[model samples]
Structure formats: C-alpha cells, structure tokens
Target chain A: MSLIQFFNVTKQYPPNITALDDVSVKIDKGEFVFLVGPSGAGKTTFIRLLFREEVPNRGQIIIGGRSISRLKRKEVPLLRRNIGIVFQDFRLLPDRTVFENVAFALRVVETHPREIKPRVEKALAQVGLSNRARMFPHQLSGGEQQRAAIARAIVNNPGILVADEPTGNLDPATSGDIMKLLEEINRLGTTVIMATHAWDIVNSMRKRVIALQHGRLVRDDREGGYGYEA
Target chain B: MKLRTAGYFFRQAALSLWRNVWMSLAAAASVAISMFLLGAFLLLVFNVNHIANNLQSNVEIAAFLQVDVPRQVSLHIQDQVRALPGVTEVTLVPKEEGLQQLSQQFGSEQDLLAATGGVNPLPDYLRVRVADPQSIQSVAEAIKAIPGVEKVNYGQEVVERLFAVVRWLRWLGVGIIAMLGLGALSLIVLTIRLAVYSRRREINIMKYVGATDWFIRWPFFLEGLWLGLFGSGVAALAVYLGYRLVLNMVGPAAVFVPLIRDQGLLLWSTLGLVAGGSLVGALGSLFSIRRFLKV
Candidate 1:
C-alpha cells in the first residue's frame, strides 16, 4: 500500500488564488522523492497539507490508508507523531540544548523518562553529533544546526520525513552534506519527501523528481533532471 | 490525571515568575494594596454595624403612669405589658422607690428632694424591654390602649434614626466589597496578561511542538494561583497587625463602641483575605489564557 496518496487535491487561498491545483500523487514506502519548484510553486503547502497544518480546499489526503481531511483537532497531534517535518529555518528552540531539543520529541510523545535518554543519545549519534549534545543551536555551525534539526525530526522514528527547503540557507558544501544525511535516513527505510530548489543537488542525487509550476504538476520521472521546459 | 502534572506546572510557573521577578513583584504589590484597602473598609463596616446593634439592644420604652392611678392598678398594668408579645422583661418602679433610687444616684441631692418633701411628685413607671428593640414602637402603641396607663414614652424618633443608620451602613459595606472584588479581579487579570506576554515566544513554541492547549496553559494558571496566594498572605498579615495596633491604641474603651468586642471577626477576615487572593489569581489566569489558547 502507498504510504501517502493525494487524490485530486487543490488548495485555494482567499481572494481566489489557488496554491495547489488538482494535484494527485502516490508515494510508496522507503522511496526518496524530491519536489522541485520555484519560490511560489506550492512546495511548502504540499508538506503542510501532509502534516495537516493546512487543509486542502478540495480533494482528500490519505496517509496510511486513512483519509486525513476530516481528522479532529485532538487527533492532529497524533497525526504529527507519524510525520517528521524539517523547516528551512531549522526551527530549533534557542533556549534548549541540542540534546534537549531532540529529546523534546520523545517527551511530548510521553516516552518513559529512562527510555528517553538512550533513544535521544542514539538519534544524536546517528546524526554524528553525540559529542556536541550539550551545545545550544547558536553554538553550532549551519551544517550542525541542520543536523540537529534532523536529529530532532527523526528522534521519534516517524514513518515519513517531510523536509521543506531543509538546506535553503546553507553553503553548497553544507547543503550537499545535509542531502547525504537525508539520503542515509531515507536508505534506513524512512520515506523522505524533500522540497527544494537545489537543481545541482537534485541532479547529483538522481532520485525520483516531481516538478510543480503555477500550482500544477508538470512532470514526474524516475531519473528526472532539473528540467524547466514544458 | 494525577497531581504530578500540576506539580510540574507549579514548578514551571514558579521558575518563570522568578525569571520575570520585577513584573511579578509589581503584580503582587498591586494585589496587596487592593486587598488592604478592601480589608480596612470591611473592618470599618463591621464595627459600625456592631455599634448600631448594641445601641438597638439597649433601647427600651418607659411608660409613666398617672399619679391618680391606684398602686394595685399600676401593678396590674405592668403584668399585662410584660405578658405581651416581644416583651422580654419588665420592672415596676414605684413612686417612693423611684424617689429613693434618684436620691442614691444623686447622693447629696437627697436634701433637694427634702426641700420639696411635702409631696412625692415623681409618678410610678414601668420599664419594658422587648425581644427586638425595633418592636418598641408597636409595643408602646399597644400599651396606650391599656386602662390607667397615662402615656407611653419610648424614644420612637431615636430608634427610627438608629435603624436607618444601620441599614445605610450595611448597604455601604456591600457596595464597597463588590467594588473591591472587581478591582482585585482587574489587577490580577492585568498582571497575568503581562506575564503571558513576556512568555509569548515560549507559548508559541509549545504550540508548534504539538503540545496540548491545557499543557501549555497549566503553567500560567498555576502562576496566577501562586501569586494570589502569596499576595493575599501578605495582605492578611498586614491586616492582622493593623487590627492589633488599633486594638492596643484604643484599649478596652473601644468595646463600648462595639467595634473591638468581637475578636472572632479578625480571624474570619484574615481567612477571607487569603481566600479572596487565591480566587482572584485563579480567575485572572483563566481570563488571560483564553486569549492565547484560542484553539
């Protein structure tokens, strides 16, 4: 069964501007898919819809074979538990240490206090930041901060990882490193749906690419290049 | 479901309160001032009402009999009046007994009575004490219809005026208490709002992290509660000290005014101050959280 299915989904903002138009797609488990588009090309909205942050104006979003369009407010948190979202800003709470930031996910999910320490340590080690766990977000380099954000995102071991411009503010080398980390996470059986405008990184990865333009799906290919032409 | 969660919130609230110490102190000071003023007003009202009640209890109607009425007739009139409804007690003062009591009251004034000793001019009278001093007027009117009773002389105008004053004081007390309660509530709300505003970023982060509304709210609510409890505690202490100081300065003579007699009122008022402070804190928190936790 598909991990996520968007059936004829369309999102419209007020004053009659459509963000996503009749977009339908299916993503299977363990597949690494990159959503490539320009600045206003509905990429963030797509990720938000999957997280239930923004409901689609028309059409259904099915996650794990359940229609998520009608999920109750109390059920939204439970839905978020199954999905990990990484923002371009790296949304790390400044007051918390790197270790605490990652551990926060487990704490919110009410994992046992004794179990939280080991799981947080493991997640930090996987991101190769076990030594810098005590450091705050400001003390880390851009690459380290992004990795810390990824650590927090995957600490709960969610089934799907939705990254929106995860490496948007990073240098080219740092962006490439972050992409590799994401690829590693994807290889470990977590389905990663990353939205980015980095053509070179997308080309180098040679993963399945989906292109969006003016809120419409222009192309979907297994070995797609950064093609802009219709 | 357990109080453990409440404990966590209490700790968080206390930490936050200390972190924002200046604002919390300002809030607490305002609460204390408001409660002190309220307590002072309450004390005044209680004492005034007490004095009025004491005066009312001592009030009685004195009915003077005509001199020509036989001694046996005056005794029969006293018995009838004493048996009437609302008559608590009756004392028959004979003409010669009244004269003798007057001579004793004014010791050397016996010579003045001897100067006019040819006749005992003072008339016999009955002093009636009613269950409620307020019923004196009705009792006097009823006694006027009795035979051989020349007239009934209760202080009708004085009693009416005293009751009027008591009623006014009771209403004033109610009004002041209501106003004070409103002031306390507003002060608490403002203080809590300021605290919430200072922690706005923390609240937003909590929300984005998928924290439930109650989870995010619990800390602020508990903070308000703690503030109210502490502020009221301080006010209650101040009030008790003030009461003691006043009592010391005024001495036992203050009891005649009925203001300082009931020491139980002090305990009850102190308890009220603490309870009021806590209630204001809780209500203020509830009001402030509604705006931030819209979902």
Candidate 2:
C-alpha cells in the first residue's frame, strides 16, 4: 500500500514566491526514493509538508491514508512519531551524551524507563556508536554526530525516515558510508525519502528519483540518474 | 503524571540549579533580601498597631463637676454618663479622693506638692471608660452638655496624634512590601530567562525531535520552582532570626509593643514568602519560555 501521497500540492509563500507548485507524487511502503533538485527547488518544503510543519497552500497530503493537511496541533506529534527526520546540521542535543540523545525520543513518548535502556543500546549499536554512548555531541566527529542524529531518529522504529541533505556536510567517503547505512535501514521495510543535491550519489544508488524545478515536479524515473546538469 | 515521575523533573531542576550555582545564588540572595525587608516592615507595623490600640484602651474621658454642686447631682452625672452608648464604666472621684490619689502619685517628690497642698484645689470628677476608644470625642462632647459640668478632658489630641503615626506606618509598610514583591518578581524573571537562553540549543534540538510542548517546558518550570522555594525559605529563616534578635535586644518591656508575640502571623508570613517565591519563579519561567515554544 502507498505510505505517502501528495496530490496537487502547491505551497506559496507571500506575494509571489511559490516553494512547491502542483507537485503530486506517491511512494509505496518500504520504497526508497531520492528527491533530486537544485538549491531553492522546494525539497525541504516537501519534507516539511509530510511533518505538517508547513501546510500546503492548496491540495492535500495523505500519510498512511490519513489526510495530514488538516491535522490539528495536538495530532501533529502523533504524525511525527510515524515519520523520523534527519537534518544536515546533525541536530543532536549538546548537553546529552550519545546514548541519552538517542533515548530522548522514547522518553518523550513516555515509554517505560526499564525498556528505554535496551532500546537505546540497540539503536546506538546499529549506528556503530555503542562504544561512544558516553561521549557528548561536541566530542564527536561530524560524521559521528550525523550518525548519532540518525540513531535518535530511528530509535522509535518510525515507519518513514525523511532525510534532508543528510550527507551535505560530509566528505564523499563519509557520505557514501551514511548512504549505505540508510540503505540497510530501508532493507528492514522502512520507507526512505532522501532530499539531496549530490548528483554522483544519486547516479550510484540506481534508485527511483523524483526531480523538482521551480517548485514543480519536472521528472519522475525508475532507476534514474540525477536529472540536474551542472 | 505520577508523583514519582514529577519528582524526576524536580531532581532535574535541582541539578540544573546546582550546575548554575553562581547565578542561582545571585537570584536567591535577591529574593532573600527583598523578603526579609518586607517581613521586617510587616512585623513592625503589626506591633506598632497593637501598641497603639493597647494605649488607646487605657485612655478615658474625665468630666469635672462644678465645685458648688450637690453631692447627689454629682452622683446623678456619673450614672448618666455610664448609661450613654459605648460607656463601659464610670467612677466618681470626689474632691478629697482625687487629692489623695494625686498626692500618692507625687509622694516621692515632696517638692511637687509642698506649694499646692492647703485645701485641695482639684475639683471632683467622673472618670468614664467607653466600649470604644474611638468614640472619645463624641462621649466627651456629650458629657460637656450635661448641666453643672465645669470641664471635660478626654485627651483627644494625644489619641489623634498616635492614630496618625499608625496610619503613616501602615501606608509606608504597604509601599515597601509592594516594592519588594516587584523587585523579587523581576529578578526571578531575569534569572530564569538567562537559564533558558543558555539552553537554547537543547531547546532547538528538542523542538525538532518531536518532543511535545509540555515536555520541553517542564524542566525550566521545575528550575524556577527550585530557585523560588530555596530563596524564600532562606529569607523566612533570616526574618525569624532577626525577630528573635530584636526581641532579645529590646527586652520583655517591649511586650507592650508585642513585636513577635503573634507566632501564627509570622508562620503564615513565612509560608507566604515561600509560596510567593515559587509562584514568581514559575511565572518568570513561563514568560521566558512562551516565545521559544511557539509552533
């Protein structure tokens, strides 16, 4: 079944600038899709709409068959629980240790304290940071911080992981390693939608790609290369 | 939330307070100073008002009769004054008894009486105690209209002056207490705001982590509570100690003033200080966090 559906979605900001214009797309459960576009091409807007952070100016967004466009403020948190987000900045809380950072997501959901430790340990292990659980965010390398962020995002086993420029700040080798980790996560039947500007990474992945330009979906292809030319 | 879980927030708040000990100390010190001054002023006002009321109770109206009046008429005047509204008691002091009492009062100073003691020049009088000291003026005026009453003396000027002083002290006490409260509130707000500002990164991370608004706010709210409670508790202790010290220095003769006699009032004041401190801290945190937590 399709996990996410955006039908005729258009997001206009103020007088004249449109961030996403009549962009309709759909992704099945467990599908891995890359959203490829140049800067200012509304890729972030697409991810935000899924989280209901920014609602569409027109049309609808359905996640897991529920219309997210009309979800109340109280319901937003529940929707977010089903969708994990990773940012380029690696937004790990500096005050918390790596283990605590990952455990925080479950804490917010009021999971039993006894169950939190094992889940946190398992998530950290999956991210290969089980040994560095005691280390604070500032003590970690850039790639390690991003990995910690991913660990936090996935700890609750969210059905969908939306990553915006997850590899933007990493070297090509580190970026490739992060992509491999994401692919492994997708193999576990979790949908993955990554927004990025890296053409080489997209071509190498050989996954379905959706391209956006001027806020409109310009192209959608299976096993596609990055459509934007330098 | 269960009490045990709520306790976790308290623990977190306490740890944060300890981590920022210097700033916390500064905030607490400000609260203590303000509350102490305010509590002291309240103590003074309470005692002074008590003293004035006690003194006023002792004062009464004394109406002197005409020297040539018949003894029966003087008796009738006393009975009439006693029957008036708010008149509690009336004692008629005849010329001889009045002179004897005057002599006894000045007996230690023989020179005070040597020149004046031939035939007892003081007139006979009816001393009247009223149910209400505040009705002295009206009572005195009523006595003056009685036939054969030569003069009425109720010490109205002295009573008015004493009441004026009490009124001034009351207003001054209120003004000082209000200023102290405002100062404490502003200090708490600023302190909590600073603490929030320092943790902005943590707040930003929490926002994107899908944490609910309440989850993000609980820690800071708890932090404010800790600061307020500790600060006010210290202030109350200081006020209590200061009261004891002042009582000892002034001695038991000050009982007429009753500076610390009403232990219940002091206890309530202490509780009020602590509650006020906690409330101020909570309010400050709430105000500071509102801007950051908006979706």
Candidate of highest lDDT: 2
Best candidate, TM-score-wise? Answer: 2
- How badly does each model clash, as a count of residue pairs? 0, 0
- With candidate 1 superimposed using the best TM-score fit, by how many Å does residue A189's alpha carbon deviate from the native? 3.2
Q: Please state the interface RMSD for every predicted structure, separated by commas.
A: 2.7, 1.9
User: Which residue pairs clash within candidate 1?
Assistant: none
Model 2, span B111-200: residue lDDT tens: 544566754567789988888777878888999999989999877777788788889988988888788777777777777778778777
lDDT of 1 at B228: 85
Model 1, DockQ value?
0.26
lDDT (10s digit) by residue, model 1, range A1-230: 79999999999999988999999999999999999999889887898799787899999999998889898877777777778878889888788899999887776555667888999999999889999999999999989999998998888888999898998999999998899899999999999999999899888999999899999988898877787874
After the best TM-score superposition of candidate 2, give how far the Cα of residue B157 lies from its true spot, in angstroms. 3.9
